[model samples]
Target: MTRRLLLSHLSLMLLVLLVLEVPFGVFYARSELSRFTHTAQQGALTLAEVCEEKMEHGLSTDLPGLARAYGRRTGSRVSVVGTNGVVLADSAAQAQALVGRNVSAEPDIATALRDHPVAGTRSDASVGGDVLFVTVPGGSDDTVPCVVRTVYALGPLKAKVHATWIALAALGLGVLAAGALIGFALARSFTRPVRALERATAQLAEGRLTDPPTTDHGPPELRRLAASFTKTASRLQHLLQAQQAFASEVSHQLKTPLTALRLRLENFEPHLAPCAQDSLDQALGEVERLGRMVQGLLALARLENSAIRPESVDLGAVVADRAAIWAAFADEQRVGIVVADAATDVRVRAVPGALEQIIDNLLSNALRAAPPGTAITLATATAPGEGGRTPAMAELHVIDQGPGMSEAERHKAFDRFWRAPDTDHDGTGLGLPMVRQLARAADGEVTLEAAPGGGLDAVVRLQRADARTHRQRPGGSADADCAGNARPHGVMAARGHP
Candidate 1:
C-alpha cells in the first residue's frame, strides 16, 4: 500500500511538470531563434546602406575588403553581387574562389537584385547545413543596383536553443526529485498511521483489547478513527465479559437443582416397577446429557474468551494414554480401541489440556458411532508442512469403522448445534465446534475425512515441538517406548466431551 501511494504521487508530479514545461520549452526555443534572426537581418541592412554609399562615391573597388572586414568582425559570410547576375566580391577567403561567378540565382540575392529586401532562414545544401540569409539592394537611387547578402550559420543558434532546453530539463529534473522526496515523506506519514491501525485491529480480533492505539498520532481523521476503534474494542470487551459471566452464573445456579433431581430419581428407582424404572433411567440419562451440554457450553465460552499459552507435549504419549482410558468404555459397547504402539512419544506445542480435550471428544464421538465388533484406531505420526519439509507437524488420527458422513454433512458438522440428519446416538451437537475451537486456541487444526475402510477419520494437527528438548529412551526409539508408567491419568473426565 505504501509503494502504491508513492508511485501515484510521483506519477502525478511528473505529469504536472510535463504539462507546464513542454510548451514553455518550445516557446522559449522559438523566441531565441526569432531574436537571433532579427538581429542578423538588421546588421545586414546596415551593411547594405554603407555599401550603397561607398559605391556612389566610386569606392566599389574597396567593396571586397570592406565586406571581408565586416565578415571577420561578425563571423558571417558576406558577398557583393552585380545586378547582371555575377559575383562582384566575396568576404570569405575560401569563397573568393567563386568571385566573378554568376550567383544571382540565389533566392535572397535574386530578391535583393529586384530592389526588394529579403530576410529568412533555409537549409542550404551547398553549405551542407541550414543558414540564416538576409539580403538588401545596394547602390544609390538611379544607378544599377547590386546585392549585399549576409549569411549566418544556423548551427550556433540551434546550439544555444538546445543548451537552454538542457538547462530547463535539468531544472525540471531537480523539481521532480524534490517533489518525489516530499511526496514520499507525506505518503509515509499517511500510511504509518494506517499500518498501526491495521495491527491494532488484528490484535483486537485475536481477543487482545488491552493495548488500543494511542489515538494521538497521525492526521486528525485517523486520530478520530483510532479513538473510535478504542471505544468499539472497549464495548466489545465489556459485552463478551458480560456474556461469560451470565453463562457462568446460569450454569452454576442450575447445577444444584439438577443434582437434587438426580438424587431424587435415584431414591425412587428401587421402589418402582421394571417399566417405571426403565422410564426413570431414561429420564436420568436425559438429565445427565443436559448436564453435559451445559458444561460443554461453559467450556466453549471460556475457550472463546481466554487466550491459550502453548507448551511442548508428547503427542504419542497423550494419544496412548487417552486410548487406554477409553478402552473400558469401548469394551462395554463391544467396540475395540487400539493405540498404535509405534506412536509412543512424539511431541508438539499446544495449550495444556488442549490435546486431552480434543482426544476425549474425538474418541467419544467415534465410540458412539462405531458398531459392535468394529475397531477404533488412535495413531500419531508426522505430516509435511506446506512446503513438505521437516520439522513437520505432529498429527493425531482417530479412525473408526462407523457410518461416515457425506461431504456436505462433514462441512456443516463443525457448526454449533448441528447434527446429522439420521443418527442413532444422542449428542449435544457442540462436540465438533468445541473441538475446533480448542484446536485453534492451541494453534492447531482438526479436520474430518472419510476413512479408507468406510468410517470417519478425525485428524488433529499441531505444531511440532522443538526436537532439541526430546531425550531418546535407552535401548528404544523415543516414539516406540510405551511403558505403562508413561500413561497420563484422570483422562475419562477431560472437558469438551459430548
Candidate 2:
C-alpha cells in the first residue's frame, strides 16, 4: 500500500512536469535560436555599413582587419563581398587564399547582392558542423555596394539547450523523490492507526480487550472513529461479561434442584405400587431430560460467549481414537463400527478439542439412527483444492447405514435442536449448531449429505494444517501425541458425552 501511494504521487508529479515543463523547454530552445539568428543578421548588416564607409574613403585595405575584429567580438566568421560578389575581405585564418574566391555563385551572396537579407542554418564543411548564416546588403551610393555574411557555429547553442533539458530532468526527478517521501509519510500516518484498530478488533473477537485503539493519532476522521470504537467496545465488553455471568448463574441455580428432584423421585420407587412406580419413572425421566436441556442451553451460551482460537491437530489420529472409543457402544447395539482412512498422517486445523467432539456428536447421532444389522463408519480424507489456488481441506466423515434426511431436512439439520420427524431420542437440539460453531471457529464448516448407500453422511470440513505447523510449534509432534485432546467448543449435550 505504501508503495502504491508513493507511485501515485510520483505519477502525478511526472505528469504535471511533462505538461508544463516540456512545452516551456521547447519554446525556450526555439526562442533562443531565433534571438541568436536575429543578432547575427543585425551584426552582419552593421559590418556591411562599416565596410561601405571604409571602401568609399579608399581604405578597403583595412577591411580584412575589420572583419577579423568583428568575428572575434561575436564568435563568428565574417566575409565582406563587393557588388559583383567578389570576396574582398575574409575573417578566416586562410584569408589570403580566399581574397579572390566567391566571385558570386553562393546563394546567400547572390541573394544579398540583390539587396535582400538571407538568414538560415545549414551544415558547413569548413566549420565541421552546422552553422547559422546571415547575409544582409548594406552598401549605397555614398560608398560601394557590398554584402556582409556572418557564419556562427551552432555547437554552443545546442550544448546550452541540452544542458537546460538535463537540468529540467534533474528537477523533475527531485520533485518525484520529494513526493515519494511525503506520500510514504502520509501512508504510514493512515495505516498505523488502521493496523492498531485491526489488532483491537481481533482481540475483541477473542473476548479479550487487552489493547484498545488509541484515539490520539492519524487523521481527524480516524480519531473520531477510534473514540467511537472505544465507547462501543466498552459497551460490548460489559454486555459479554453480563451474559457470561447470567449463564453461570443459571447453571448454578438450576443444576442443584434438578439433581435433588430426580433423587427424591427415585427414592419413591420402592415405596409405591408397580403401576405408580411406572408413572414415577416417567417423571424422573422427564427431569433427566430437563437437566440435559439445561446443560445444552449452558453449552450454547458458553460457545456463544467464549474465546475461540483453532489449533493444529492430527486429523487421522483423532478419527482413529474416536472410532475406537465408540466401538464398544456400537457393539452393545449389535451394530458394527467401521473405521476407514484413519491411519494417514493427516494434519488439520481445529479447536483443541473440537475434532473429538465433532466426531463424538456425529457418531452419537449415527449410532442412534443405525439398526442392529447396520454399521457406522468413521473416515478421514483430503478434499482436493481448487487447482493450486487453494489449500486442500481435511474432511472427517461419519457415515451410518440408516434412513437419510432429504435435501430440505439436511439444510435445516444445522439449526438448534433440529431432529428428523421420525427420530425418537431425547435430544436438546443444540448438538449440530455447536458442531457448526466449532467448525467455523476452526475456519471450516459442517455439512450433511445423502450417503451413497442411503444413509446420512455427516461431514466436518476443516482446513489442512499449515505446512509449517511442526516448525512453528514448540513440540513438533504435539498434534500426534495429543490426538484425543481436540477441543470443539460447547457441542456436548448431557447425554452424548461420556
Candidate 3:
C-alpha cells in the first residue's frame, strides 16, 4: 500500500511539473531568440546611420569595406543598397550578383527605405537557410541614397534553445526523483504502525495476549492508533487473566464450604427426626446444584480459554450413548426417549464431551417445557455433501414434544444469559451459548427450530468422521441410551442429556 501511494504521489508531481515547465521552457527559449534578433536589428539601424555619414562625406567608396568588416565581426551578411532599392555593395557574397538586384520589392528593404529599421524574425527556404532578416534606412536623412541590411542564420539560436530544453527536462526529472523518495519514506513511516497493529492483533487472536507492540513512529495519527491498540490489548489481557484468577479462587472457596456442609449434613443425619431428614435432604440437593453450577462455570471458562480440539467418533454410537443416559430420566417424567439411527454406521469429527454436553443442555431445557408422557426423540442422520456427490455429513438432532420457541426467542436462544420469559425453571442461561461456541470450535454449527408436533428441535451438524472403524451392534450399553434423556425434579427438569 505504501509503495502504491508513493508511486501515485510521484506520478501526480511529474504531471504537474510537465504541465507548468514544458510550455514555459519553450516560451523562454523563444523569448531569448527574439531578444537576440531584436538586438541585431537595432545594431543594423545604428550601422546604417554610420554608413550614411561616411557616404555624405564622400566615402561611398568605403561602403564595401565597411560592410565586409561589420559582417565578418557579427556573423551576419551585410549589404548597402541605393535609394531606388538597388544594392550598392555586399559582404560575404559576390557584389555583382546583388548590386543590380531590385531590393525595393523586398518587404524589409521597402520598410527600411521609409527610414525605420524593419525588425522581426522569420524562417524561410532561402539559400542561406533559416535566416533572421534585419534591414535599416541609411542615416537620419530619408533622402540618403543607401540602406544597410543584416542577415543571420537561426541555426545557432535553435541549438541553444534545444540545449535549454534538455537542461530543464533534466532538472524536472531530478526534482521528481527527489519527491518520490521523500513520499516513499513518508508513506512507509505512516504504514509501519498499522502493519505492527495487524501483527499484534493476529498474535492476540492466537492467544499470545501478553506481548504488545512497541511502534511509535510516523504521524501523530499513527502514534495514537498504535497507543490505542496497545491499551486495548493490555486491558483485554488483564481482564482475561483476572477472570481466570476469579474462576480459580471461586472454585477453591466453594469447595471448602461445600465440604463443610456435607460434614454438617452427616452430623445432622445422626440426630435427625424424620422431618429434619427431609429438610437436610433438600438442603443437600441445593448444595449439589450449586456445586454443579460452579463446575459448569469453571468448565465454561476453560472452554473459553481454548476449545475446539476434535477427534473422530462414531455418530451412531454417540447418539446411542446419549439416548441411554436420558432414557431412565425421560421414563421417570413419564416421557418416552427414542434413539433413532442408533444401528446405522455414521461418524463425525468433533469434541465428544462438548457435543454430549450440548445435547444434554438442549434436552434438559426441552424436558422442563414439555408435557409429561410426551415422547422426546434423539436422532442422527447423514448430511448430503457438496454437489450431492461427496461423503455425507453427520447430523445429530434432539426433538422434544415440548412448548416451542417463538422466532424472536429462537434468535436470542444462543445468546449467553438469554432465557425465554415463559421459561419457569432454574437456569444459568449459559447452556445454549456454550453449545454454539463449542460447535463453532469444532467447525460445526447448531440450530434450533420448531418440532413437528409442538416443541423445540435442536440440531447439531458436524463433519463426518472416517468410516474405517465403524461397528454396528444390535444392542449397545444402557449407559449409551441414557445419554440423551432429561430427569424431572418437580417443576425444574435437569441432568446431562445426550
Residues 212-303 of candidate 2: C-alpha lDDT, one tens digit per residue: 99999999999999889888999999998999899889988999999899999988888999879779977987897788678767766776
Model 1 segments more than 4 A misplaced = 1-10, 104-131, 135-144, 173-196, 214-223, 246-276, 308-360, 373-401, 405-412, 438-498
The CA lDDT of each predicted structure is 0.75, 0.78, 0.72
lDDT (10s digit) by residue, model 1, range 1-498: 788988898888888888888889899988987898788878877887787777778898989998999999988999988778788788888778898999878777777787888888888776789998888887556454678888888888788888888988898899888988888888888887788888778677666665678777879999999899889989988997898789779877989999999999999987999879779988998888778667667667766776545677888777767778778888998999988755455678766677777787788788878889999998787865555333467888889898888888888888877777775445778778876776666567889899996998898887777533222111100111111122322122211222
TM-scores for all candidates: the values are 0.70, 0.84, 0.57
Models sorted by lDDT, best on top: 2, 1, 3
Compose the digit string of candidate 3's lDDT tens values, residues 275-359.
7888898788777666655655665676666523466777776666666777787777788888765438766766646566667
Assess candidate 1 and give its TM-score to the true structure: 0.70
User: Which model scores highest in lDDT?
Assistant: 2
Over the full model, what C-alpha lDDT does candidate 1 score relative to the true structure? Answer: 0.75
Cα RMSD to the true fold for all candidates: 8.0, 5.1, 10.3
Error of 2 at 126 (Å): 5.7
Error of 2 at 212 (Å): 2.5
lDDT of 2: 0.78
Candidate 2, which ten residues in sequence have the lowest lDDT sum? 470-479
Error of 3 at 60 (Å): 6.6
